[model samples]
Target: MGVGDVSKRILLGRKLRSAQLGETLLPKRIALPVFASDALSSVAYAPDEVFIMLSLAGASYYVWSWKIAIAVAIVMAAVIASYRQTVHAYPSGGGDYEVAQVNLGKTAGTTVASALLVDYILTVAVSISSAAQYAASAVGWLQGHEALFASAMVLLLTASNLRGIRESGSFFAWPTYAFMFAILGMCLFGFFQLVAGTLPDVESADLVISPAPEYEGAVTTLGLLFLLARAFSSGCAALTGVEAISNGVPAFKRPKSRNAATTLLLLGMIAITMMVSIIVLAKKMGLRYVDPREFDRMTYFDGAPLPEDYDQHAVIAQIARAVFLDFSPGFYFVVTVTGIILVLAANTAFNGFPVLGSILAKDGYAPRALGSRGDRLAYSNGILFLAGMAIVLIIAFDAEVTKLIQLYIVGVFISFNLSQLGMIKHWTRELTTERDPDRRGKIYRSRVINAVGLSFTSVVLVVVLITKFLAGAWITILAMLFFFAVMRAIKGHYDKVQLELAADEDDKVLPTRVHAVVLVSKIHKPTLRALAFAKASRPNVLEGIYVATDPVETNRLIDAWDERNLGVPLKVLHSPYRELVRPILQYVAEIRKSNPRGVVAVYIPEYVVGRWWEQLLHNQTALRLKGRLLFSPGVMVTSVPYQLRSSEIAREREEREDFRVRPGDLRRGQVDERRDPGRRG
Candidate 1:
């Protein structure tokens, strides 16, 4: 095997056969982590956001924490119930984009696709950036390099996911389950202590939170409502990954829709529990956290302003410390798992984005490359593209979770509202045709569920826009619009190309005559071989064409051709500007213009070398000439390859690679065969 094959094997494991795709289908246990980690991991930071926004109004506003949590939980439940209908109705994995496209027309479908694309990207950026922050908190040296760290983590996740979904799911399942167990365990233990009146206070309990200057005095009812709306908008980050399951229903094992719906229900319940528990615990423990950028708003117990350097631990971290104050391991364990899960959360995006991209590609709204899977049955191109986009975002925002989180849930909520609305329309239409009373009743129930979901999500999306538009949510809106425009443009371009390429009744008609031109640079072995090959083809008119870059060389080549008594005439095209490719392309076009019914064949000699750098030294002119000539009508471009000595090594390596044993071959009891069908004499 060549070095690239070896490296790829090490990085992505052995390629799976198409028949083995069934093995990559994920069961519920593994699918939860693969698809729900993002929603689950939000507990580590979403509550922190809630606390941050509430702190803008001082500790007096802390009473609203549980209220916001409950509101978010209710919306999440509605969204989940709505999507449960989506999975059963449209289980082909297009999710919201499919429903919207099929029921609401192409424009709405494209809008949903663009929103989901942007949201998936933000999911990766937010999740990785949050993980970097947690890492910086755990290790002091990691403070200023979070962007680099986050970018590297994205690359790692991309590689892991390229190994296929089930493998990655299994690999990630343990950490996700561990996180769930640790957080739920801590919450249960903390609640038990609370019931017994023995819960401990957090480290920040003594620190007093003062409202920002705007909220210091008595505020109007509208101002108070806006403040609560802002807090709730921030808390809605918890719902960011709920639609991932709906988008990924096809990835589930047997009874795909049922399994996916069950997973969605489990994901919503767990996310709601964790989020609410964290918020309640934060309020109970008097956890004080505000945007560090708003340092003047926080104060010590003695009325002194907090120092600019005060590093506020996350809300979950504070609760973990306070709840397990006596046991150092418990605190460390919780913090460690929280950070790991935050990083793993991006895996959900890695899984969702590629599938959605593939669907878009299949629908002709994206580049066709995204529709092809890698050797491992994973959408490798889409995975790598998502990682690259996430890296750009991480670097652009400097991996600050708070800043990245501001642009977080807007796209998600947009998708949610549109999807729910689409589902409502879908069921309404179905109910009209579903005559069985029992089935009609189910459809009616589904329509009502989706209608409620739409109502709630529409309100939240408005609140998110109002609360976050000026605070960076506009960037996400702009990005979604940009993607929408680009996809539409791509679709337009593809449609034009398809129309231009359509075959007609005369497409199979033969050309009247064939004229072959062998491109010649000098009187060398490659040129002679090209001349000989052209002669063997026996075209009606065969000629050796040369561009006269230098008069002396051109004359010498003519003299050499005469001396060899070559039967084919040599035609030299003079170039005053010393150009090679343009003159050849222009010459071919002239030939076609002279005899429009004839086909012109341009054979260019190209040297094939083994090493990559060697390639740069050769084929420069031949490749350019071929590229230009291929665009001319009635012309065909061909490359006659001349293999160099180093190319032998490459050939041997490829030969060996062809016989390499793939995964499952041994298990299937297949014999290793090194026999080559094209063995050279």
Candidate 2:
């Protein structure tokens, strides 16, 4: 049909009927990876973070690494348990926002939403940056171009997601499972080697780490606690994506809550296992890692710095190298899966953010377009927005995981704490209403679980704030605030518009008189058609108005009108400055003022062409005039479309096409089979 329609058809491909949306429902196999990649991919950088923080007191602080991991694990468990209850109780897919709104209040719900939105965006930025780091380590050419590589990865992920959730899930599923296997496989093998007393230490084992300038000296008791707290906070990155499953419960097949709960349990187990294994292996292999800035402390024999260009592999990379030294394939497998999983990890945010955005949109907090689905049954706008934000962050941070990681986990923990508190309130209210003994007991138990979760997450949130805020977490807090203000502003705008445009008691009262004005650019077929249409309305007053921009054209139109004897009077609006819209608008305003109780109807003759470029050439002034008239009170604007011969070709081509997929239709899985629903045979 039109160029816009053709481009859209090409971009989205053949559209499936909305009824076929059921086919896009994910099975467990695909759902696990689609939802779990974010938390699972955390293992790639979580250990590095823990080690970096511990490097403050050198390798001696390493022993506390495992303890910090345990603290993070406990918090992770609490959050998972809490969200499992959320999935069961609020399976409508509102996740924390709905829970907080219903149990807490609108303000608390909006706060959680703000936090989660920031977190989801950070998830994409951090994951892509981490993947870029891994890629740099794997390929020398990607080292200095980390930002570029990271941006490309984001684009690739966006394209994959644009294909719809089901298709993208299937595409990313293997890498997630492969990552699970690779990490687990490496850990198991490393453990056996340790048991056999044959485990070779990592290449960095013999290297020494120099403490930061601030932490130099004997570690005081207070200093050690602070260091451990910071390390624990860093390790809490592992828990960043735990709430995503709760946010995405509706994505699962039938029995959505049960499947979502099971997925949460599975995610927790796998994430905990992989995280602990990596930490344990790093310790056993004597992995000595430091912040990239202080990395000079690591040296080879002869007290010389390692190659200036030497790729300092990640903790998992080093451990994989040592454990699979004799097994090259296994090492490559681990590296490949780790990199892929890191990139795919953003899918967790992609899946969660759109669903959350949809909920917000439906609740009048976001643009209404995001509330609908795209042809592929995906939230395309939400996905693109997330990708765009991530790319901006990636470029700004130069795709450095360490810097981006500092901005991670803060928003999620805030959401986690708020969600748990909401759940506690929810259960308390349920207990009051329930009269059945068995159900009441179950609710009471759930309350206890939620209480424990709230306590744990509250502590973690505080620790994260205290430890990481100065280390760059304040950026994330600022981001949350920014998102909160934006969402509120959008809601306010929508509300204000709704109130202003809403029909009132006076709307039913008929106007005292109707005055019709036909806008004529040329006395041609289009103008004739518009004049005929305007005359049919039988207004109390009818006149043809034209801006006298050109005297020659004005004279020609007057002569033509007189020759045709159209009977309608012609009014000339003089504009020496050649301001078309302003003059016409002023004329309409004067007319309306002359008869306050009369309605002025402006009929604009619009050229309807097949090509988009043709539209640009024609109707430029008419469009702007119509837009201005819409905002004017007592002024009704109508477009009298005059379709040209070219429009027929476009209409025929559209009729021949089988279907079309529009934006937002993919999310809801709706497909338009007909070219135009209003078109008749």
Candidate 3:
């Protein structure tokens, strides 16, 4: 094997045969964490966001935090129920894009795809950065290096996911479950302590929060309502990943829809329970939190300014500390699991985005390479693309969760509302075509569920837009628009190319004749092979053409050609400027000028080398010549490869071995057949 092949094997492991795809299917146990981590992990920071927004109006507004959580929970439940209907109806896993395309139009489908893509990218960035913040809080050495740490986490997640969804899912499942237990355990313990009248106040309970300059003194009723609305909207970040399950139903094992719906229900329940519990605990423990940017407004109980380097813990962090006080192990455990789960939340996007991207690519709205599986049966390109974009955002935003979270939920809610709207339309259209009364009643019930989902998500979407548009959500809107335009352009390019390349009755009419030219440089095996192959094609006219840069070498080639008694005629063109490419290109253009109706077939010999360095040593002229010929109308370029000794050794090794399927290959069902009989020579 060559160095390139050896290196690829080292990076990706053994190549997998296509037949083992069944092994990659994910069961509910693994799929839950794989697809639900994003939504579930939101409990770590979503409440923190609510607290931060409410802090804009001072501590008094904190009283409404749990109310905001309740509103978000209701919307989340509605969305989850709605998506359960979606998975059952559209199990092909196109998710929102497929629903919109089939029920709505292509434009609507592309719009949803654009929104979902942007949302997926932000999901990774926001989730990883949030995890990095939690890590920084736990480790003093990681304080200012959060961006670098977050980027490293993203890279690690990307590599793990490149192994394929099922493998990565299994790897991430335990930590996700651990997080679920930690948060739920903390909430239960904290609630029990409150019932026993033994819960202690948080460390920051004595701190006083002064409102922002604009909100100093008592606020007007209208102003307070708007402030509460903004805080509620920010809390809705918890709902960002709820739609991912619907988008990824096809990734589940047999009875994909049922498993996905169950997963979604579990995700909603856990997220809601955890979010509300955190909010209630934060309120009961008197946790004082604020945006670090507004630290100047906060004061200590002794009427002194707080420490200049004071680092406020998150809402969950404070709750964990208050509940686990005197038990250092439980405190560390809760914090560690929360941080780890937040990072793994990006895995949910890692699973959903590539699947949706592959569907788009297969439909010609994305690059075709995304539709092709990689060595490990993963959508490697899509996975890497998402990781790279997330890393960029993490670095650009300096891994500040508050800043990244501002750009998070808007895109997701946009997708949710549009998808629900499309689902309602989907069921309506289906009902029109059905004649059975029982089936129609079921369809009507499904529509009603979707309608409720649409109403709830639409309200949240508007609230998010109205409240957060100026608070970094506009950036996400611009990003979604940019993606929409780019996808549309890609679709347009694919359509244009398809139209131009489609074979028709006109294409069947052959050229009046074929004029073949052999590109000759030296009297060697490569030249001989090209000449033999061109002669076998049996064109009406044939000639050996050479660009003469050196007269002595040119004369030597001519003498050798004549000495061999070669029947093919030779045509030599002289170039004083030593321009090899221009001379050959000029000759081909002249031939086309003479016979506009005939095809000029250029025969170029190419060396097939085993080693990478060997490729650099040969084929410079042949490569450039073929590139120039392709730009010329009515011209064809053919490569007649002449294998080297090293190539033969490499080929022999490949022939002796059979390919085996690696991890994740079973899910994609990709097959590699033996070489065709016609290609053996």
Q: Which prediction has the highest lDDT against the true structure?
A: 1
lDDT of model 1, residue 216: 80
lDDT of 2 by residue, 1-681 (tens): 556665765766546567777877887788999999999999999999999899888887898878888888888888888899999999988898999889888888889999999999999999989988888877878879999999999998888887788988998998899899889989999999999999999988978777787788888898888988889888989988888888888888988899999999999999999998899889889988888876676676567887776667899989988999998999999999999999999999999999999999998888998888887788889999899999999999999888888888888888887888898888888888899999999999999999999888888888888988898999999988888888889989999999999999988999999999999777888998999999999999999998998999889988988999998999999899999999899999999999999999999998899887888898888888888898999999989999999898888777565465557666753354254565523
Best-fitting candidate, measured by TM-score?
3
Return whichever of 1 and 3 wins on lDDT: 1
Q: Worst ten-residue run, lDDT, model 1?
A: 671-680
Q: Candidate 2: TM-score?
A: 0.95
lDDT of 1 by residue, 51-121 (tens): 88888888888999999999999999998999899999999999989998998899989999999999999
Which residue ranges in model 2 land beyond 4 Å of their true spot? Answer: 1-11, 300-302, 659-681
Instruction: Order the candidate numbers by lDDT, best to worst.
Output: 1, 2, 3
TM-score of each: 0.95, 0.95, 0.96
The local distance difference test score of each candidate is: 0.90, 0.88, 0.87
RMSD of each: 2.6, 3.3, 3.1
Q: Is candidate 1 or candidate 2 better by lDDT?
A: 1
